[model samples]
Every structure is written in C-alpha cells, then in structure tokens.
Target chain A: MAPALREFCYWMDRYRRVWRGTVVISVANPLLFLAAMGAGLGKLVDANHSGHLTGTPYLDFLAPGLLAAAAMQTGVIEATFPVFQSARSGGNYPAAAATPMRPVDILGGHLLFVAFRVLLSGLLFLAVVVAFGVVGPARALLAAGPVLLTGMAFAAPLMGWAVGVDRQSRLNGLYRFVVMPLYMFSGTFFPISQLPHWLRSVATCTPLYQGVALTRGAGLGGSHPGATAVHVGYLLALTAAGVWAARRSYTRRLNR
Target chain B: MGDESAGAGVLIEAVGLRKVHTPRGGGEATEAVAGIDFRVHRGEAFGFLGPNGAGKSTTMRMVAAVSPVSGGTLRVLGMDPKTHGPAIRARLGSVPQDDTLDTELTVRENLLVYGRYFGLPRAEIRERATQLLDFARLVDKADEQVEALSGGMRRRLTIARSLVNRPDILLLDEPTTGLDPQARHLLWERLFRLKQEGVTLLLTTHYMDEAEQLCDRLVVMDHGRIVAQGTPRGLIAGHCTREVLELRFDDQEAAAGKIRHLGDRQEKLPDRLLVYADDGEDALKAVHRTGVEPLTALVRRSGLEDVFLTLTGRTLVD
Candidate 1:
C-alpha cells in the first residue's frame, strides 16, 4: 500500500473510538431539517404560493438543498477544528512525522479522512430524505454526487484556512463572520432570486449557493445541462485551488 | 574499549552539520547548530553535555531525521538524513525533551498506537507493548490513562513507546530533566540496562552526574560549538584538577584573594571560592595554617561542571 493510504487507514481506526459524537450530528442534522423545513415550512410555502417555486412542492425542493447544506456544515466543521487540534495541542501530526510517515502523508491522510466523512454524511442525508418520501430513488442517488462535491468545495478551502491559523481563536472568529453568513444567505432556505440585485450576485458567487443550486436543480427540478456543468466546473476549480493552498500551508507549518 | 567500538562501524556520523532557524516575522536567522563533527559507533553510549540553548537538542533532532539539515552532511544508520529520513527514522527511536505521549490513551495504548505508526503488525505491537510496559516499570499503570501518570511515569512511557519498534539506536534529549532525584535514578538505571543490552545509546544532558553515570564518551558544548570532547574522566583529567577545595566566608571577594597561594588555581563564585588542588584536604589544612578562619570549607572530586567552567569560564547552569 502507498504510505499515505496506510496512514489514512490508521486514522480510520483512530476515528472509530471518537465517531460516536460526529455520527449523531451526521444522522440528526438532515432529519431535523426534513421535519422543520420540508414538513412545517413546506406547508406554508405551498399554501401561500399557488404557483411559486416553479410548480414543484416546497418539500421536494427543500430536501436536496438541505441535504447539500448539511453536508457543507459537516465537511467544514471537520476541516476547521480537527485540523487545528491535530496541529496544535493535539500534536498528532508531529508525532506521525517523527515516525516513518512524511509530511505529505500526514496532510494527505487527514484530507482523505475528511473526504470520507463528507461522503458518509451526504449518504446519510440522502437516505433520510428518500425515506421521508421527499424525492424518488433516482434523483436522491443523483443528488448524492453534487451534494458531496459541494461539501468538498467548502471543506478543502476551510482546511487551507485552518492550517494557516496561528491563534486558536481565529478559527472561531472565521466561523462567526464568514461561515455563518455563507450558510444563511447561500440560498439554502430560499432562492437567491428573492434577494436584492447586488446581494443576489454576492450569493451566487459563494460556493454554498452553487452547492444548493446544484443539488436542488438535480433532485427536484432537472437542471439545464449548461448550468450543471458550470457549477461542477466551479466546484472542481475551488477544490483544486484549496488542495494547492493546503499543501503549501501544511509544508510551511510542519516542515519547519 | 570505546575505540574498539568505533572500529566496529559507526551508526551515526555527522560532518560539519548545521541548523538555522529563522524567527517569525522575517527576523534574523538564529543558527541553532553551527557546524560540528562527531560520530556514534555501534553499541556505544555517546552524550552531548551542555547548558540550555547550547544546541544539543538541535543536533539531536537532525540525527533523528525530523528537522531538516540546513548544511553539511548527516548519516544515521548509514543513510543520509536529508534524503532518506523515513528509512533512517524507521530504524531509530527518539525521546524528545518533551514527552509528547498520547495523553488520551492508556499507557499500553500509547505504545501500541506509536508502533502502528511505524507499520508494525498488530500481534507484534501487542507483544512488544507488554514487555515495554514492564521495562518502563509501568506494568501496574499499563491500562491507566497517560494523563494520570506523574511526570516521571510519563517520561518513562514516552521512552517505552519509542522502544516499541525495538529500534537499533535510541536518541534521548535530556531524558531526566524535571524529574525528581529518585525518578532520575530509576530512568538512569533503565537506560543503563539498555546499554548493557548492547543498544547504541545517544543522549544529551545538563546534569554533570547524569553524563558521568550514563555516557561512555561525551562532548561539552558552548555557544553552538563543541568546546571539549572525551570520556567524562578524560575531560576532567584534561581540563580540571583532580580535586577541589571549596571555601565560603562572609566576604567571598576578600577570601578569594587570601586563598590564592593555597591551591594551584582558583575560581570565584557568588557565595564561595573554589580552589583547584591536587589533594583537597592538604589545601584545606593549608587554608587553616594561613589564619583566614573561613566560615565554611569542604573538599570534593572534580566533575564535568569543573571541566565546563575551566573551558568556557562560565557556570553550566547559569
């Protein structure tokens, strides 16, 4: 096996001992959104808008968007706090570096584990939304790919930002100022078209908005072919850039 | 005896090795390990004796293949550390200044997890962990969390964890620092046993007694350079007198002048004056004959502290 892959497997074994708390949030986040938005808020949106939401039921429209948003939340959380902890007081990466593992192996293994987490949570969200009868199996399965891509689009960048953090409080400050605002205004709860002219452009430019649009367009109303490619391309570009930045940051921090 | 081991082939050899660390914010680079040459032969205990900031730890990190070498050459287990770090590190065990033990895991779990990092098999890790716990004298605490262990126990566990791979060479950087006297002795005994078992032991320390007890040969460092190198006895024999007579009076400065003729040489400390003598008792008797009536006086054999002070004209701890 490749050394990086072997290191990744070591972390998987390590995660089993701490998986209880994260497993709870991964299963519960989508279910809560399904109940509150798809059932409760869906009724009001359906009643008030006779033909709004492109004639699609609000419940079906919200399911995949919430799934994508939930994935983004899970992925970003994994990238931020855990990355800092491993580098800072946790000292896990340094310990591994002292062994036969290289700096590249440590960085690759951590990102690989985070990717697995994003995919697992995305799958869980898809299952619950499908079980709730919000969307059929075909769209639910297709939505899985876009949902995971959206999560990576957010997670990979957060990882880059997390590695450059010198102070512990910097991460918390980022969550409050940047992450929270993006989560709220990224068209997760409503369409960006409802926002003002300038804000609509700002919302569309953020990664989470593209994530919400992609999953919603794929799962509820089938997307225009050209639009889907643009979202996919934008996310792939962000992931590529984020990986590059993370590699640079980790090398500077650990190889010193 | 040490010369015989040197001809048996070297495990670690460094030629003009160096390390430079640039301060954050683009400040001037501080050279931690200025160029120095040394070698550790197979199955010999070598030591680097120095005060804090004397570049001992920096040198150890380079040999461990963790920190990058900035200049010159370093080979551990016959492989260049700059290029073959993973392969070099795989065959060596390192106990850093700080424990860095996995605090959340039990003592046994810490050993097992570290072994797994080296890609050791589960059955092998399990068996090695059991023996290491006993070797570290933590058999009773094997299942207890590392956080609950005392400072000495934690240090021992860290040393034990490093040994889980049964490494051919062990590098310890001030292994007994901050440990109590009894704890220090216990660790020394364990390290001594490793040496007896023919493991190549390389350690660093500020304590003169630790160097005298554990090292077969050592180098005294000052200002990022090796000022003197030899066995402990050889260093003392070369740089210091055989014995020392210590005299303390109400006024140390005045007494220093008075005691000039009493011994072959003298050094003035804050509260005491050290008179280097071939026979310390004869020097003490001579001090009484001079009618100085010193407040306190004693005689002791010379050690590495004397050797360091003789070479650098400064105290080791200060």
Candidate 2:
C-alpha cells in the first residue's frame, strides 16, 4: 500500500467507532430540513409565487438547493475542527510524521478520507430526495456529482487554513462570519435575482452559489452546456488550489 | 561478535551536526545543536544526558530524520538523512517525550493502525499487536480507550506502537521524565531487555541514575554542547574522586573556610559542602579535627552527578 493510503486507514479505523454519532448531521439534519422547509414552508411559496419559481414546485427547487448547501456545511465542518486537532501538539500528525509517512502523505490521506465522507453523505441525501419525488431517480443521481464537488471545493482549502490556526476560537469565527453567510445568501433558499444588483454578483462569486446552480440545473433539466462547464470548472480549480495549499501548510506545521 | 552482525557497522554517525531554528514571525535564529559529533555502534545502548533545553531532543529529532539539519552531515543506517529521510525513518522507531497515542482508539488498535503505516500485511500486524500488547503489559486493557489509561500505561503503549515494524534502531526522548519511580523502573527494565535482545537503543534523559542504569556510553550536554562523553564509570573516574563526603553545617561558608585543606577538592552548595576524596571517612574525620562541628555527614560513592557538577560547576536538574 502507498503511505498515504496507509495513513488513510488510521482515520477509517477511528471513524468505525464514532460514525454512529454522525448520522444526525449526515442523514437526520438534512432530512428534517427537507421535510420542514421543502414540504411545509415550501407549500406557501408554491401556492402564491408559482410563476416566480419558473413553474417548478418549491419542493422540487428547494431539495437540490438544500443538497448543495448541506454538502458545503458538512465539508467545512468536517475539515475544520478535525484538522486543527490533528495539527496541534500531542496530536496524530506528529506521531504519523515520526514513521515513514511524510507530511504530504499525511495531508493526502486526510483529504482522501474527507472526500469519502462527502461522497457517502451525498449518496444518502440523493436517495432521500428521490424518495420524496423531488426529482427523478436519474436526475437525483446526476446531482450527486455536483454535490460531492461542491463539498470538496469548500473542504479542501479550509483544511489548509485549519492547520495553521493557533486556537479553536478562530474556527467558530469562520463558521459565523464566513460559512453561515454563504449558506444563507448563496441562492440556496431563494433566487439570487431577488437580491439587489451588486449583491447578486457577489453571491455568484461564492463557491456555494456555483454548487447550488449546478445541483439545481442537474435536478431540473434545463441547463446550458456552456454554463454547466463554467460551474464544474470553477469547483475543480478551487479544489486543486486547496490541495496545493494543504500540502504547503502541512509541511510547515508538522515537519517543523 | 558474530561475523554477519559485525559487518553491519555503525547505526548512526554524525560530524558537526547542527540545527538552527528561526522564530516564526521575526527573531534571531538560535542554534539548537551546535556542531556536535557522535557515533552509535550496532548493538549498544547510547544516551544523551543533559538538563532541560540542553538540545538533547533537538539532536534526537535530527537523528530520527524528522527535523532538517542546519549544517554538517548526518548518516543513519549508511544513508544521508537530508536526502533519504523517509528511507532512514522506515528502519527506525521513535518514542517522543509526549504520548501521542490516538485517544479515540483502543490500546490494541493504536498498535495495529501504526503498523499499517509501514504497510505491513494485516495478518502480520495482527500477530504483532497481540505480542506488543503483551510486551507493554497492556493485554488486559487492549480493548479500552487510550484516554482511560494512566500516564505510565499510555507511555508503554506509545513504546509498543513504535515497535510494530520491528525497527532496527529505537529512539526514546525523555521516556521517563514524568513517570513515578516504580513506573520509571518498569520502563527501564523493559528498555534494558530490549537492549539485551540487541535492538540498539538511543535515548535522552535528565536523570543521572537512568543514564547510569541503562547507557553503556553517554554524553553530558549543556547549552547545545557536549562537555564530556564516556561510560558512566569512566566519566566519574576521570572527573571526580572515588568518594564524596557531604557535610551540613549551620554556616557553610564559615565551615568551608575552616576545613579547606581536608580533601582534594570541595564544592559548597547552599545547604551543604561536598568534599571529594579517595576516602570519604578520612575526609569526614579530618573535618571534625578542624573544629567545625557539622550537624550531619554522609559518605558515599561518586557517580555521574559529581562528574556533571565537576565538569559544568552546576547541578543537572536546576
């Protein structure tokens, strides 16, 4: 086995005993949000502003939006505290670095595990969305690709930043000032076109907006190929950049 | 020595090895390892004995192939550390000062997962985990979380985890620094057994007795420099007398002036006076004849403590 894969087994072994507690975030939280917002609150919006929703039901539009948003939340949440813990003194990064594993191998293994987590959660969310009749099975399955990519785009760079953090309080600020704003305003719950002009452009620049657009287009079936290419390209480039940053941060923090 | 084993040669060789750490923001770069030279033979226990912040851990980090060297050259297992760090590390096991065991995993899982880092086969790692649990005396706590273990147990597990690959050389930095006496002795015994089994051991410690108990050879370090290097007995013999006579007087300064001519050399500590002489009993008698009535007196064999005091003119722990 390669060293990175070997380091990956360490996290997998740890997750085996603690994965039960995470079902709430991965399965339950999204399910509850879908039921309350998509079915309950969505009822009022569909009954009145059906024309504004482009003739699609609010439940249909909100399901894929929630899927993309949930991926962002899970990806950032998973990448932040765990990365900080591993990079801290008396943590596993130093221990792993003591063996044949290099700092790059350590970062690679951790990101690989994060990708697995995002993919697993995305699949679960898609299955539930399909059951609700929000989108067809084929469309829901296609949406999974964009959902996973969206998660990685957020998770990868945050992993790098978390390694250099001096304390846990910085992570809380990131959630409040960065992640929460992106979640609330990135065209997840409503269309960005409703926003004032300048704010719409700002929302479009955020990674979560691209994610929301991709999943919504894949689920509803009317996206232009050129626009779809743009969304995918943007997410791919961000994820690659995040990986590069994480490699540099891990070497500086762990190897020292 | 057997021919095959003898041909293996020195396990580690360093010439003027150095490490300089530049502060993160903007500060002067301090040299942690100031151009030191040392060698470790294949099957002996070698040690670095020094006080805290004496560059012992820094030197150990460089030899373990984790910290980059600032100057000079270092070779481990006949490979240059700068170019072949991963390769050198593959054959070595490191037990750091802190216990970095995975707290979420069980004691047995810690060993098993660490073994996987070396890409060992699953069956082999399983077998190794069982034996290592037994070796660490953690068989009963194998299924328990690491957080539930005591400091000593956690330390033993750390040591056992480092051995999963059956490494050729084992590096321990301050292994018993925070343990209780019984725990320290237990760890020492385990380390002694490993040394007897011919797993070359390199360790750093502040306790003079630990060095005397385990090290076949040692170097006394202070301020990033080696002051003396030799076997415990040889170091004591070279730097101190055969015995030390300690006297506690109400006024040490006054008593020191009175009994100045009694011994070969005298060191006055805050509470007592240490007289170095071949015969401590005779030295004590000489002090009494000089009309200085000490409240208490002791005669004992000289050891590494005196050697360090004689070489550096200071105590080791302070």
Candidate 3:
C-alpha cells in the first residue's frame, strides 16, 4: 500500500503541471449547469407548475441531482482518457512497470487519483450550489459524500473498460449510446416517478439513479430508512466489483 | 549457448529461454523465442544482434522482467523473473525499443517522476536528475516538454531516466534505431561511459558496427535461435577469412564462371560476389590475372556481417 501511494505521488507531480486547466473545468462545470438548468429552466418550471416539483423551489430539487451527475462525469472522465493514455500511448505504465512498481500498484494509484478528483469535484459542486442559495442548510454538504461515491462507482468499472479498449475512438460510442442516455433519463433532470412505471424500473436499475436518489435524500432530509442501506450497499458492491475487474484487467494487459 | 561473460561472474544466466505471445482476440499463439540461451556477467557489455523478427526485443523484455518467460530456467541478479519480478526489476534499469516518455512533462520532471517510481527520495532524485541531465547533455533543455524535443534528445533523456535508480544492470533495446549517425554516435559514447562506470549493459541491435563497437560479447540471432556467439573479432575469425574481396560485375554469369578458383571460397550475391581469402590482395591480383575487368572491386576486413552471412546464409537486416 505504501509503494502504491508512492506511485500515486508520481502522477501527482505530472498532474500538478496541468492542474490549473483541470481546476478551471471542474469549478466552471457546476456554475454553468446550475445557472442554465437550475436558474433559467427552474424559473420557467416553477412559474407554470409550482407544487408538482416536491413542494420546494425547483432549483433546490434540481441542485442535488446535478451534483450527483457532475460527480459521475468527473469520475468517468478521470478514468477513461488518462487510463488509456497511461497504459498505451503515453508509455507511462510501461515506465512504471520497468520500475519496482507492480501492476496492482499502478491500478491502485490510478484509481486513487480518480477518487481524489471526484472528491474535489464533488466539493466544488456543493459549494457552487450553496453559494447560489439553493441548498437549504449546512447539512446539505452531507450530500457530497454520496455524490463522490456515485462518481467513484462509475469510475472504477469504466477504468476496466477503458484499458480493455484498443482505440480511443471506440469511447465515442460509449458516450453516445450509454452515458448520454443514462444522464438524460436517470432522474438528474426530473423525477423518475413522472415517467411510465415500467420506464421507472429501468431508471431505477442504473447506478446514477441511485446516486441521484441518495444525494437528493441527503439534501432534502427525508430519505427512506430502508432504502439508505440498499443504495449504499448497491454502490459499494459495484465499486468493489469494478475494482476487482480493473485489477485483473490491468495485470493482464500491463504485465505483458 | 552457455557462452560465459567476458571474465565477470554471471549476473544473468539462462538456459533454453523461450517466449510465445498469444495474439489478442483469440488468434493462434506465435513463438517469438525458441529456447535460446546466453549469459551476462557483472560490469560487461553484452548484446543480442538480430533483425526485426529475430526476437531480440522479446529476449530483452524477459530480462527486464516485464514479460513472462514461457520455458527454461532464467535468472537475473540470481533471482527468478517469474516470481521475483519486482525485486529483480528494482535492481535493473530498462530502456525499451520505443520512447514512452510522458510527453506532457518536462525533461527534468520526467527523470524526477521516474525516480519516484523506484521509491527514491525527492531530494535525492533531484540531485541525481541534475547529474543525469548533464551526463545525457540535456542540461540546457531541462525545462522543455519532452514533446518539443527532437528524437535524439528524447532517446538520451529516456536513457538518463533509466539511470535515476543507480541500477546495477541496464537493459537497452535498440537505443539508436531511428537516430541519425551523429545522434547514434553521441548516444553510443554516453553508453560507453556507463560501461566504463561498471554498469552491466544488455543491448540489442541489428547494426553490426554498433554490436562490434559497444559489446564485449554478443550472440547472433536468426529466426529466434542463436546462430553464433563470441567477441566481434572471435566470431569473424572463426567463421570468415581474414579479409574479403568484393567484386561487382555487370555480367554476373561471366564473373561467377571465371572467378571460382581465385579465392579459398566464393559467395555470389544478387549484385556482387564476395571472394574469401587469407590474403585479399593476392585474391585481387589473381582476379586481375584472369583478365576479367569488373564494374567495381574492393578488399575489406571481415566483420560481424560476414560472420552472420556465413552462419545463417542470409543478410542481417534482410
């Protein structure tokens, strides 16, 4: 574990050079989404349909959903391009393999950096929403934990997928076919209950919907006691499984 | 091929080492190494001389402990690569055939970051990076991104980065494959200095001149097998005559029929014929005495290329 952390620090030095660009993107992301989706669209919805959006201002209801979605996107981005680049094009993985570092250490270090970015992005998202005066109280910050979890849950599995892929262009199909559809229908923009009951089941089965539910419950303060364990369990199990697959895949692909 | 290193106790020992790569998407497995053996001792520069498909890089990869061995007993620093890969790798440095530097990082930072992979202290790594940059003659370009540098500079920086750990054994696979003559000479000079500093070097090359210049002992590989092994002079002396008379004739059939008895042995190439003799000048005079005026003629010392041609009956690069 210590050696793995040392490997993590190596990337930190490299990441430090381009961190400003990452910070600008991470900090700017939530402000734009909250301004456009929360302020502009929420006012129109609140004016036409007041009580239909869970008895609060629509901005308050939408803030937490966007937070979870932002976290998921941050985690996925961290894992996809960088993981593929490090292993193949960038030649960093082979360099590390030539050293004392093992394939597991490389995978651990990569995932560790991704988790850090997700946490940072999650915190930035929460602060943006709080500064806009949308979140009700201080406890709204509690939602950041589940949001980061949701991000990592998506990140770990996507890392395994990214390293297994040969061409970077194939990732476009993943975004267009899989990620975009989930982002639109996974209760980030609206409540899943508004959809047909059968469509709600499909939305419920996805990880982002659970993330939205967990974060929204934490933000609004009325999460069902029974579903809390279920959501946490689902995300934790997915994270563990994803990490296992990533470890195996990295060992096979990297230790050639 | 149990050829010992040049007077140094063996640091690397192998017997019938083999490698077979299974192509992705479930294709048939292709054998890259066919049970070849060699050894490298401390403070000696050893090499594998072969062409593109001769499995030089595969053998180098196995020695680096990044690629697993398929068969035979192999030891690096007296440790088995199959189980003690990390432990063995921690003691050795590797420069692969291709440059994989993190192009985003500056040259100095590339060295610094690679040192951290070996778990070196930052202050120590910083100190060593300074020395290595000077050694590679890249001190002036320390702050430049690797992507901005030329290919020769990147190759030097890559070699310098591998030395950050002060490793006992250095494995360089075709360190100068794409460089121009000037750049290749500069790199070779730096590598010779490392060999003088007592770093055990294991390099692979198809350039016979490079093998002869940098290697104390080397093995000639063809089609995944060791065809010959010795010092550059030893291999040439054992397989070829003292000198060769190269004659190019526009009329190939006329030269072949007439020059058969001029030298001890004769080889007919597509464009030229090589006449082997203990005294090349005597063979040239004998050719002239036959009254055959050729298109071109020259007498040269036998080299690793002649030895390779003798053992494999094929050109090294072809």
Candidate 4:
C-alpha cells in the first residue's frame, strides 16, 4: 500500500510537470467557449424571449451544461492517450511491473491520479462558470461534486478502452465518430428537446448525457430529485462496468 | 579468488521449466523454453549464450517474473514467481533488452522515481541516486533530460537505475549488445565490481568474448533447448580441440578439401578453412606437407564459439 501511494504520488508529480500545456489549454477552451456561445448565442436567446430564458438569463441556462461538458472532456482526454502511452509506448507500466507493486496497484494509482486531475480541472472550469455570473457560489460548490463524478464516469470506461487497445488509430476514430458526436448531441450547448426523438433517445442513454443533466439539475436548480437519481444510477452502472473491464485488461496484459 | 564459501548457497533453482508463446495471429504455439533445468549459485555470474531468436530472452524473462511459464516449475530466491512475484521481484533488478527510461524526466529524477517504485525513502533514494550517478559517470548530466543523453550514457543510467533498489539478483539481457568495445569494457569492469561485492548476476549475450570475460558458467541454447552447459573452459575443453588452425586460400573449397586430410576434425567456412587439433602448429606443418600452399595461415586457442559451432553444426551468427 505504501509503495502504491508512492507510485501514485510520483505519477501525479510527473503529470503535473508534463501537463502544464494541457492545463492551460483546458482552462482557455472553456473560457473561449463561454465567451463565444454564452455571450454570442445568449444574445439571440434573450432577444427571442425578452431578456429571459424560462424566466432565467440565457447565460445561466448554458453555464452549468458547459461546466459538465468541460469536465467530461477533461476527464476523457486525461484518461485516454496518456494512459495508453504509459502502458505501451512509454513502457512506464512495465517499469513499475518490475517493482513490488502489482498490476492492480498500478491501475489504481493511475486512476487516483486521473480522478484528481478531473476534480482539479472541474474546479478550474467551475471558477470560469462563476465568472460568467451563471450561479451563486454555494450552488457552484455544490455542482462540483456531480461534475467531478461525471468526469470519473466518463474516464473509467475510456481508461478501460485505452488498456485493451493496442493501436491509437482506433481510439482516434472513436474520439471523432463517437465522443465528438455524443458531446454535440448531449444537451451541453442546448436542450435535449431540440434534438430529434430517435437521437434524443440515444443521447439520454449516454453517460455524458446523464452527467450533463445531473450537473445542470444541481447547479441551475430546475431538475427534479427522481430524474437526478436515474441519471446517477446510469453513471454508477457505467463506472462499475468500466472498473471491471479495466481490471481484467490490466491483469491479462501484465500477467501475460 | 574471493571468499567462495561465503556465497555458496543456491540462489536460483529451476526444475524442468518451460514457456510457450501463442502467436498473435494464431498458428502453432512456439515453445520458447522446452523443459530446461539449471541452478545458479550465490555470488556467481551466469549467462545464457545463444543467437537471436534462440529463447535466451524468453528464459531470462521467466526468471525475471515478467513472463509466465506455460509448464513445469521454477523458483527464484526459493520463492515461486506465480505466488510470490512481488516479493521475489522486489529483490531482483532487471536491465531489459531495450532502455525503458522515462524520456521526459531528468537523469536524477528518473533514478528517484524508480527508487520510489521500490518504496525507498526520499533521503535514501537521493543518496543512492547520487552514488549511482557517480558510478555511471553521469553526475555531470544529472539534470539533463534522458532523451538528450547518448546511447552509452543512457545504457549506463539504466544500469544505475536497476541498482536503485540495491537488489540481490541482477538480470542483464545483452547488456552490451550494441555498445562499442570501450563502453563494453567499462560495463564489464563495473559488473566485475558488482560480482566482487557478492551480487548474483544473470546475463544473456551472443558475444562469446563477453561470456568468457564475465560468466563463470553458461548454458548454450538452440531451438529452445539447452545444448550444452558448463564453465567456458570446461565446455571448450570437452567439446572442441584445444587449438585451431586457420588456412585461407583464394578458393575456400580447395583449401577446405585439402585441409580435411591434414587434421582429425575440420570446418569449412566461406572465407577460410579451420583445422581443429590438439596442437595448431603441428597441424599447420602437416597441412604444409600436403603441398597445398594457402594464401595465409594462423593458429589460435579454441574458445566458446568453437564449442557452439561443433555442437550446433552452425556458427552463432550466419
């Protein structure tokens, strides 16, 4: 356990050093998206609804969804290529395998680091959401828990996929064909009601969709408790499945 | 030369160990280790001498606990790798065929991070890293990123990294495979010092001179089987004649045909002819008496390469 903790800390420190560019880019993208879509598109929504959106400002309706989307993106990106690189190209996991730490410890240590990055990046995005005057400070703090959980829900499965994948080409295709499409359709920038019925069904089933709905409900205060519970259930199921798959992949690859 | 009795206990023992790797595309499974048995005593350097694709790395990997045995039984430090891998691996240091150093980290940071993997304390890791940097002669480049270092420097740093845990058994796979003569000699000297300090070393190499210089005993493998195993001198004396005579001619076939009649044993290579005899000088004289004037003649003592060629019916390299 002590060795696992030390390995986790070492990776965290290494990531912190190597990920400065990523952190900057992550912080900048959310701020830019807010300026463009929140400010630009908020004008159109407000003008159409007489300076109100369902009796709230246009920015308020969009801010929480953006926060959730940013967290999911941060988590998936943090947990995907870098994880694959450590396991394969960088041979970092092989180096760790030579130590007293087992494969499970290695995976757990990496997940710990990914979880921390998700939370920290989510907090940074939350600060941006607050700067846009989207929610009160208390609600924003409350929103962080679900947003961070949403990040983990997305990260867990992506990490599983990363381990089983031997090539980056397939992951690149997934990001383009699956992740981007899901992000666009998942009600981050708009309401799911705007999507077609068949597409809406697919969007509602995705973990990101549930994450965005849960975060919006907690941050913007219109989502009901029962609806939020359903979303949480889906995320929990996905997290469990992802963890099991990741454990199996790590054990198979390492032991072989 | 040192106190041999102090390090006489068995350090590694294997009973009919075997490993089979199924190809990714699924054909017949290749038996990489086919029920080989051997024991390595404490404080002695042992080697696996084979050419490429000869199962040397596979055998080393099993002993390192990174590769599982498909059949038979094996033990390192008297611990089964399947059950006690972590404990067994903790006391073992491995230098793999390729350098796996973290390219993004500085040399010092690499050592520190690797030591941390072994649960070493920060102060102790720092001290050990410092000493290793001095041992590898990379103290001047301690702060430089590993990617910027040369190959020899990186190889040395890797050796240093393996010592971070101060392991009991050190496994080096082709430790000087591509190194220059000077670098290879330097590494051999460092390894000799480690042997002197009573660290049990296991090495795999294709370089016969390397085996003769470092290994006290070695196993020659071919086609996933141990063809011969003994001390270098013993194997040479047992399998090959004491001396060899080389006779070169413009036409290797004519020289080989003529030389065959001059000695009890002979081998014909494309470029030259080799006559194996207890006395190379007397064999040369006998070949001269055959009245076949060769372009050049040379005589030298036999070594491991002769043994490998005599047993395998081929040289270690094509």
Candidate closest to the true structure, highest lDDT = 2
The backbone clash count of each candidate, in order, is 0, 0, 0, 0
> Candidate 2 DockQ category?
medium
Give each model a TM-score.
0.91, 0.94, 0.94, 0.92
For model 2, residues A1-256, the per-residue Cα lDDT tens digits are 9999987888898888878877656777768888999999998998897555877788888888889998998899889998999887688898999988899999999988988888888888888898788777887889888988999999999999999999899999999999999999998998888889999999999999999999888988899899999999999999999999989988888766
Q: Chain B TM-score for each model?
A: 0.96, 0.96, 0.95, 0.95
DockQ of 4: 0.60
Tens-place lDDT digits, model 1, residues B1-318: 222333457888889988999876898999988999998888899999998999998899889888889888887877877778888788889887877776777788788778888988889899999899999999999889888999999989888988887888999999998999999999999999999998899999999999999999999998788999999999999988999988889977776677688787888888788999999999999898877888998899999999998888788887
Q: DockQ winner between 2 and 3, please give it.
A: 2
Q: Is the docking of candidate 3 incorrect, acceptable, medium or high quality?
A: medium
Highest DockQ scorer = 2
What fraction of the genuine interface contacts, i.e. the true contacts, does candidate 1 reproduce? 0.50
Cα miss at B129, model 3 (Å)? 1.8
> Candidate 4 clashing pairs?
none
Complex DockQ, candidate 3: 0.64
Residue lDDT tens for model 4, A83-186 = 78877833788778877888778888888888888888888788888887787778889988888788889888788778767888987888898778877878
* Tens digit per residue, CA lDDT, model 2, B108-179: 889888988888899999999999999999999999999899999998999999899998999999999999
* Interface RMSD (one decimal) of model 3: 1.9
DockQ values, each candidate: 0.50, 0.75, 0.64, 0.60
Give the worst 10-residue stretch by lDDT in candidate 1 chain B: B1-10
Question: What shift in Å separates residue B178 of candidate 4 from its native position after superposition?
Answer: 1.9
